[model samples]
Target: MSAAYRFSVSIMPRDGILDPQGRAVEAALPELGAVNVHHVRVGRRVDLEVEAGTEAEAWTTVDRLAKELFANPLIESWQIESQPVTARMGPPK
Candidate 1:
């Protein structure tokens, strides 16, 4: 049986890139009784799962998704990685 593979893609702007939304969130953290957090920038995350015959193909698909779907393609760099999966046997009925 072909195993199931999972991929997680995290998209974020490079350092020194301006993020108004992230700054807003950081500023508001104090209002929630949370402090001591600094230099916080926000990004997006996309989770995808597929059963592929090969690991190479799984990586390729994720790259395409990062370029065409998740990232802006102009001002963002993305990181995509495959997670290891080990099957756990359930109780036999």
Candidate 2:
């Protein structure tokens, strides 16, 4: 049986880019009584459970997927983290 791995990807807009969502949240913070909230930026995280033969294979597959489907290199960047699954949770619900 193939081994299962968990991958987490973080994608964020590059610096100096306009972040409308972040701006909206930042503006609302003052009203919510949040103190000293500055330079707020918004980003997305994606998690995946994949089956692969080995850790190296899993990393390679995830990296390729990230480049092709996850991040827009022109305006965004991505970070990837991965680990082998020792126990089965029977997929995410």
Candidate 3:
């Protein structure tokens, strides 16, 4: 039987890649009294659910989507985390 799994993907710019948004945030932080902050990188988190027969299958599905549709391979990288969903913790009806 296929099980529901929750996946969290964190996408970020690859190291050494120029991140204008990150740089802007980093610069603004110091002005906001965060003087010790440095090398700040702004990234995005994607939360989703997948149905598959096994954890590996769920991971594969998310990994494929993250690589092909969610993240830019040339400039960004992504990490995936998964957790099986229990009946008691299922999504709202």
What C-alpha lDDT does candidate 3 achieve relative to the native structure?
0.85
TM-scores of the models, in the order given: 0.78, 0.85, 0.88
How high is the lDDT of residue 71 in model 1?
97
The regions of model 2 sitting more than 4 angstroms off are 83-93
Give the winner by lDDT: 3
lDDT of each: 0.79, 0.82, 0.85
Stretches of model 1 off by over 4 angstroms after superposition = 1-3, 85-93
Candidates 1 and 2 compared: the better one by TM-score is 2
Cα lDDT, model 2, residue 36: 78
Note the residue pairs that clash in candidate 3: none
Would you give me the overall lDDT of model 1? 0.79
Off by over 4 Å in 3: 84-91
What is the lDDT, from 0 to 100, of the residue 54 in candidate 2?
80
